[model samples]
Target: MTLGLDEEHRELGASLRAWAAGLDGPAAVRAAEGDPAETFEKVRAAAAGMGLAGLALPASAGGDDGSPLDVAVALEACAHALLPGPLLGPAVSELLLAGGHPGSDAVVGLAPGAPDLVWDAPSATHLLLPAPGEDDTWVLVEAAAVDVEPVVALDLSRRFGRVRAPWSGGVAVTGLTRARVRRTTVAMAAAEASGVARWCLETATSYAGVREQFGKPIGSFQAVKHLCAEMLETAEAVTAAAWDAAVALAADEEQAAFAADVAGAVALDGAVRVAQTCIQVLGGIGFTFEHDAHLYLRRATTLRALLGGGDVWAASLAARAASGVRRRVEVDLGGRDAGVRDEFRTRVAEVAALPEDARRAALVERGYLTPHWPAPYGLGADPVTQLVVDEELVRAGIGRPDLKIGGWAAPTVLEHGTDAQRERFVRPTLTGEIGWCQLFSEPGAGSDLASLRTRAVRDEAAGGWRLTGQKVWTSLAHEADWAICLARTDPDAPRHRGITYFLVDMGSPGIEIRPLRELTGDAMFNEVFLDDVLVPDDCVVGQPGDGWRLARTTLANERVAMASSRLGVSTERAVALAGDATPAEQVRVGHAVALATVCTLLGVRTTLRSLAGHGPGAESSVAKLLGVRSRQDASELVVELLGERVVLEADDPQVAADVHEMLMTRCLSIAGGTTQVLRTVAAERILGLPR
Candidate 1:
């Protein structure tokens, strides 16, 4: 959900987006790089006239008070457009204001002499340059104390200057502290890096979409899509880290420092990766002086050094995080020990050694498999342990042997099954017994699964129920021993309350299962027809109309399953890919580290929110959006790096295997809830935007 925006900040972002979409943009920025006087004048005018420089500064400092989130939105827009200027200047100003400085005419300072750098010195009516010194006291030099010399910049639109200022300008504003300023500077650098990184990803993606190679959009190539995907991932992670810093700043100073350190390290690494990957996407042209790619790289380099570099920040954070913090705290048992650590390795290897038939048997014998299954529930395994068992199996690369609805159905039966029903049905499920499939979805029912029309009627003489209806997407039904059916058993009741969950024997007369193949080339989904099938009264689960609530538990488990799975590739594989790239591409591998760092930041944010008792919210949507975009970015980059060999789709076997990912990348935004849907969700939930 878009968080409700303050009208002014919302307008500011909209204006920036509108403005950046126009003109030659990066070309203009590139052209101005050589002419500092012209570029500075243009950027300073845009920033000041747009009122972007002091957005978050308090009103006491001749500024309209705003917040960091506001500035983030504005900067995100600027980054989206690849605009050059002080997107972080406002954030810096906010820090200054918070520190009790009311330099009504204060201007922020940066490392004074990088010609190609577009450092923050917006045409402030009163420039404040903090001179380098041994003492904690800041010597703020006025505009006149500064002598600006122009330098040729890679991005002409953003010229850099050499500033020579006196040791002191004006008295320090009350409340400004050296410690606060230092921390704020580091955080602002991270924010700037985030802006540049995102721009690189979006810019590269735009180019890939229109730039044709091999008679198709370059994005069609798996290598290209993956490169773009990776870029998106890097950008996303950086954004999250930066935002986490902002949130921490909002909450507490110490947390702010920690967050900023993490953000600075991650964003620095991400910026370099994004710049290099974008250049790769642009091919040979990206390396030339004529292109704007180098300009961004230059900025990334300058920023990386400006904020103490990644190593320094990372080391600092490591030291701080280790000090008195719970380094080995106990975690929730469900997802623990699934990594390739010692215990994880042993269990997986043991499971992997078992043959198909023996694996299930071994699992039953060893008490590792369905640890939660009720005695009548089929197999008696603890739920938490069962979750860990599945996790271990997946970690070991052991495919879950096909178990139809029986996997889900037996649990319902055991939970609410009769003694006779459990004796007859649950035993076979534990032995190399029959499988079961869920017959829940229908031609009209999907996300709205309760609107099912499958009917089951009482048959007094047969002492059972007769079912007649069709169920679509019944995975693995053809070889199932039973079907977990949800039907409209009480039509007069509320839609949700009217349904009943039942276990139907697959061998019953008039039941049919037809397989349907999915994008993965697997016959895992099917359509099932139940015609006059008889299910005894003992097969019904729970009370007659409580199926909806019971079904919710199963659906919730599905989500939990998805959330706990290994969501990305191994670090070893990523390192190998990085090793294969050129020296420049090795710099791109830093992007992988940046991505992982950002993922951690996202986890932190999610944890914080969850602690506050809220759902993942817009942050989750942002994470998802960023994930798909990053995957596409990485895909594109790989293809570009792979070069001519990318043309043979699935032809070389190795590269060809990636063809599926290439195809899948196109649908990344559309799956797991489309990016558009998520964007709307973010707008409503996070931004609190109007419908």
Candidate 2:
């Protein structure tokens, strides 16, 4: 889905898409490639007439007076068609002219340097050239003064011409007007990338669904389906990144710089990757000149090269993050939250004013602790309400104790447990009086949890059930007061069936906990031995032989929190470590920043889906899959940036921490769900591939 796009943007994109579809974009691009000077004066004139050249310019200056975001929407639609034109360059020039340049009606071509690879240079009346040694400052040169040289580029759909020295008619643009031009250029470029990725995704998916192989559609094949799924994730990321960049630039927020860099870091890569994957999914036909896939690929790659690649932008983003730059998402409460925000904020403030020790109790009592939970236990808070409460609490300097295992356990208990079970466990868990741990994973049953061998036999004499099993990788077992566990209850039943879900007191006799040191040199995880551990009938979370279904609740909770929370770890670490980074290092840090931003956007989309009464669909799984990769990559970058100090020294605390964090991040992929397993699931379940 396109992130944060309103109806106007959607219609704008649709209208352009329709217009380009009728023009046969591929044929036009092919025509342009064959003869660079064959000047489609009519086609360029058509785009200009449609206001493509002046979308962001003011009506006073004879233009649409659109915002940066509106121009971005138009560019994306244009990119979908691989439509050949001087749209981006002209948009830059018009925005410059609207910023108070004298020649508002002149056709302008924008080039970063000495007019090398500049669009429409031979055709334009003027060229907008950046000043040699100044940042965000440019010189407007009349086209007739600079001799133009035509050349072929990787993207055959677009024409390019170069212009060099000894040119007069130079007018300088500095200050705010120059800065706006720079940022808007980056934002529009990102939007173009986003459009390219979107087109690739739609083309590949549509092709895969119809293209047959071995008597079935290729989309039915796991490999093709997974590739398409990856393209979907990339496309979504590009959209989110581009949209944020556009919004930030238009709003002129402090986040504009980092947002622009993030867009640069993510959008260009996504465009290229998605385009390449589109070709892969389409197979041999994708590689042929007859197909339009190569055109988009060329455009994606060329744009990336021109922007100096994702690494360059990523490194700058990292430095800003290090300097404490944050992209605070500006949300307009609008009519949706306006009615409830004040009352909710006021009540939240009242509870927050209480003593720190008493705040948790008050929050639980007033249903502010877990707003998403049902009434009597929580406020049954919708997404909007929850956000309001979060904002209010953060404002008041109040905090709630994280119910780690309780987040999953309490939800399971609320959904499947009895009234008595809910009364006894829910409040205490939410109030921070009781801590919980999960004993669901073992050596053999982590991802394949159905394969658990731990047995739970009914014991009549003790008047309960006895659980005997070895549960490994149980975090907080050394400190938790209780645990929600899964054990096999029926030997005759299928692997997925015959298991039961139970809550056991950690203090129960015959329970043994052994700390397991990790690669990070920490022992937060432990091996628990449950030899003759007794759990009463009331402790059964649901009916016997229902563990598999109940386990899904726990996993669902894990998936919800997966990308959102883990995203901060590497980002915070990267920010802490990135101090005045070199260009190369900035690229790496920028990559991390972009990934972090995407992770946040994914969460926002998931939340929007939840609020809309739709399941997060496959994107939720995609988030976890991509998140693990991002965090691991980011973690490795940290160590790589440290040179050889990481390998040579453990005495330095900072070095030691970096080393430990680097090693610990390895588990990111292995834990929750292995990257390989999740990809397969996304292919089969999300992308609708054959098992």
Candidate 3:
């Protein structure tokens, strides 16, 4: 979660964090305020002794031969302790040197744009600057050759200075290029920003747990809980972005610049925002210099500024995306599933050879359609087998039929239903012969589904039950042959205990479906009225008064699906809209690209965890929350780009489609769970905030 996924990286990060903590970083920063030069020298020497300076250099150069990812892991740990001095500059300089430059061991300063101001100039023994009037050329000059005037910086932990020098002879560094230098710098800075964000989140959440107001902890309050939850989301985003950038940079991929731009766009700004929120959570104490909150805020802000601000990064990202550059995200798998993959590929190929109309039935017959389900119904595929099936299906150009509500209904039926119930529903649903609609939510109980008041009374004479309820926001209700309903079977029982799960025939005499038109003028959702509908005893799933538990049942055999590309539908559309975009539009597009990519990375991390035999991490839940924002924001940006055409009934079909998409995305936050409620859940359940 702290910019590393594997055990080795975790151990490295932990070791570095322990080392940094022992240094008393805050005290070091305070000491630097009085004697900057001496403090930096001492800190630099200690870092060197710890082998931190040579982490990114090759082993041939008497270094660790660490990749950018390893250096990022180390940087994240050091920054978590608020380690003072020039860690990023020297590491990035060594990365650029690639162990070829003779001055690799020296404290190297980075002059990204203007030579007048150089980062870490006060502590740097040499400087890397762009060659005069040469766009791609770079030069390395010794700091002793220039007149260095130390300048006061916002970040007291690191030093910056003005370099007074003429455009003269210097060593031409062939290893350096503007793109590579910028990407490397952004990747390292993002790692540091992630550490700052993580520390702020941890500090604020810890304080929230014990900080008292009135008669109890402030964390018990909904407002404070929501704030802490938002902080968690932001901190997670920063970590994901930073991690991905480091990975791409280390791989030396064609999309490395694109990934670095995303990191710069998301992590830098995200860190600053999280730090500010941390201060807000800490109340009056955070405003005083005695608190460490301001220090993190200063570091985050400085990183964003030195990297030319998030807007510039976002613009560059948008440009790259517009040119069709996309980052590929996939699990390495390490050939562990080679045999299974070959078997799946062969079976899938057999299915693919069939006529288009015969493929669905063939897939269902072989348990290829729902591979994650238990045998007979599916292959009972593990995560690796599931991925192999998915790849083979895609490779064979065979798209599985969407089960819609059946996907949810059949799982419960399989888990808790009678053998006869599974026989009646599972296979038929998979074969697309039976359609399902979920009738769980009522007008008054949407996200708080346990509050549903739909009643079911025992029909003693008829040997059945009489059901009466009003279900809202039911998708495909008009087309469904049956429904999975939750009815209050015992009025005397507790709220959650009284419910019963029922399989209702949608064609029953008293059922009525009313289409509910959305802002997009579509009727995809509906209201279903069930009045005195009869359901036999055989229609119920599990025992009576057990609907709540059955409804919440999540089979361990859940399907695993991953995005094929980092750019999602809305993000791709945003890129298409950026052809003639204004500067403001480009920034928005870039921000959208960064968010979408982070969402993908979160999934990638979660998938990686599963492949490694680890339990689910925070990424799964966090992905849902961030995904809604990313989709909604991208769609809104698309409509905005369309200008007046979005509002007008224009001849352009694309404009209307864009407008519709923008409106339809409004339901994303409200569908599975409202954003406000999810934030509360994230705080209480994930962060362990008091209810």
The number of the candidate with the highest lDDT is 3
TM per prediction:
0.52, 0.86, 0.95
What is the TM-score of candidate 3?
Answer: 0.95
In model 1, what lDDT does residue 682 have?
Answer: 44
Between candidates 2 and 3, the one scoring higher on lDDT is 3
Q: What's the CA error at residue 61 for candidate 1, in Å?
A: 2.7
Would you list the C-alpha lDDT of every candidate in the order shown? 0.59, 0.77, 0.87
Q: Report the C-alpha lDDT of model 2 over 612-679, residue by residue, as the tens digit.
A: 54556545666787787787888788787777777788689988877777899899888877776776
Q: What are the per-model C-alpha RMSD values against the true structure?
A: 13.3, 4.0, 2.1
* Better candidate by TM-score, 1 or 2: 2
- Winner of 1 and 3 under TM-score: 3
Clashing pairs in 2: 311-587, 314-590, 315-586, 315-587
For candidate 1, what is the TM-score? 0.52
